[model samples]
Target: MIETNVLTITQLEHRYGGVTVLAVPFFELARGRHALLLGPSGCGKSTLLHLLGAILTAQAGRIEIDGVDLAALAPRAADDWRGRHVGLLPQQLALVSSLCVRDNVLLPAYAAGLPADEQRAQALLAGLGLADKAHAMPHQLSGGQRQRVAIARAMYTQPRLLLADEPTANLDDRACATVVALLARQARDANASLLIASHDARLVAALPGAAVLRLPARGELPCAA
Candidate 1:
């Protein structure tokens, strides 16, 4: 039977040198829903995001994305699957300094061995109000513009799930609100499930009604904050 959920994690655990850094008994994010993974630094929020994005394999337990088990994929197949179905917005916004905005947005398609869809890239840029900046290099854009470019890149593939890691780091209140709104709007438009990992309590209010899963610092009990 096909799975309706975009993501399902069961008994997920990751460790570094036998010290468990992240653990989740069970979690599910329904398709097209927005959820937040909230916790303090070193509480494994990033680790969880990486595991879900297939950047780091879980040391134990099961992860199913649309009913396909993550551990079942070979390395190459995992990369291709991630590129095609998972949209990642990492905190660093790792845009290629040498590539222009448009090319940067198309990078995922190239990496996935998919044809470059220039039309989709253009639409995403325009939607983010970055149409005129398409030819500009990363350095030419402001911090917020750079963030938007990263978001466009993540959304360019029209991924089934969008995962953001600390997207609001270092932003002021107004900027944070803007960024959160943009992410939500884009995710809604793309019909993709959204999962944001953050330590910011401001997000709890900014994203009212989003499912909140508060992880604990190591050795503490997990509860929603």
Candidate 2:
């Protein structure tokens, strides 16, 4: 049997404004595997996630997601490919202020220029216990509800690689477990590889069969922030 990696980073070195902030020797996540990135707030966990998501370009490194080298693609090409192949839930969620929950979840499909599947979007919302809030705005929902909306949005496209940045942050113990389970289940159902960057220990314990990547806390925030 041949093994294929869904996410790979080699000699990754990222700098911001003339300072070296993140340097990762090597990392790999195979398809359908769940991996947790553990680190302190300023340890470049988020930086690594952004790099994998194609939000930021690494100064010196190789990043291959689902076999495509991210550094070689043009910006628009990268963006389009990411839209089609990667499901990203950043720390901020980045939900549109004006769009309702339904539309927000559908944003990825829309951006990918794919036909809208309202049924799929609603189904995901229902699974996340946000069916009633499908019409609600971001501000109207609680933090956990909003987090679920983000999860739905990320899963809407059924991506091959799911990158989550601190998805369990700010939630209580129960909420944290719920979100982690949802993410794990959704990734399994989709056969997508899940790579989460978080400082939450409970999250680390909750993920079964998940490989871990740990980063050290370096006191100051990265310049890329």
Candidate 3:
């Protein structure tokens, strides 16, 4: 039987300033499965992720996650939908530098209007070896540690679908492997579908089976018509 899908996109076409960046005839991710979107930089991988994560509406095509067609929902409804089911780790890691470690991890749950549970938050941070840094600011943590904190924040709310964009760019091989494994395990335990966009082949090789989405090129300054 076909697994119920967590996210799906059909004939997606998006452009920036009239320059076509991505064109996917079809893309689908089954519930609890993981996929990797790979390509050179500027190939629209990030753009595609944004669309699926509900950060941007597809300029043309259809996108559905957890049975909800994002295009049809109002902005407020879409935000609610994302908060309840989608977890995103953007390229920047996007951690608030001013917030203490624990507070940063708990922000997602707070934003979703869910009651924050201190015990659960602590467990996640500790599991990632961040227990001691619970009060540390973002600037105080090393790059690898910062990335791990980002992962914890994403999983804190136990979302049904997780989107990670260039999550391991700053780490060394060992650190990269550790982070990848942690993410896969977390997604599996939460029964969440994970879609990661990265240029790292090592990461993709480690994932058992991950679909890849390649992007179009950035040609002559004006690009071909």
Best by lDDT: 1
Candidate 3 deviation (Cα RMSD): 2.4
Q: Write the per-residue lDDT of candidate 2 for residues 1-225, one digit (tens) a residue.
A: 798887788988888787777877788887668899998787888888888888889999899887789999899998988887789998998999899999999998788788999999999999889889989999999888888899899988888878999998878888788888888988888889888999998876789789898876654434333
Better of 1 and 3 by TM-score: 1
User: How high is each candidate's TM-score?
Assistant: 0.93, 0.91, 0.91
* Runs in model 2 lying further than 4 Å from the true structure: 219-225
For model 1 the local lDDT of residue 13 reads: 83
Q: Give the least accurate 10-residue stretch of model 2, judged by summed lDDT.
A: 216-225
Structure candidate 3, residue pairs in collision: none
Q: What is the Cα-based TM-score of model 2?
A: 0.91
lDDT tens digits, residue span 38-148, model 1: 999999998888888888899889999988899888888888888888999998999999999999999998887789999889989999999999999999999999999
- What stretches of model 1 exceed 4 Å from their correct place? 1-3, 221-225
The order of the candidates by lDDT, greatest first, is 1, 2, 3
Error of 2 at 120 (Å): 1.6
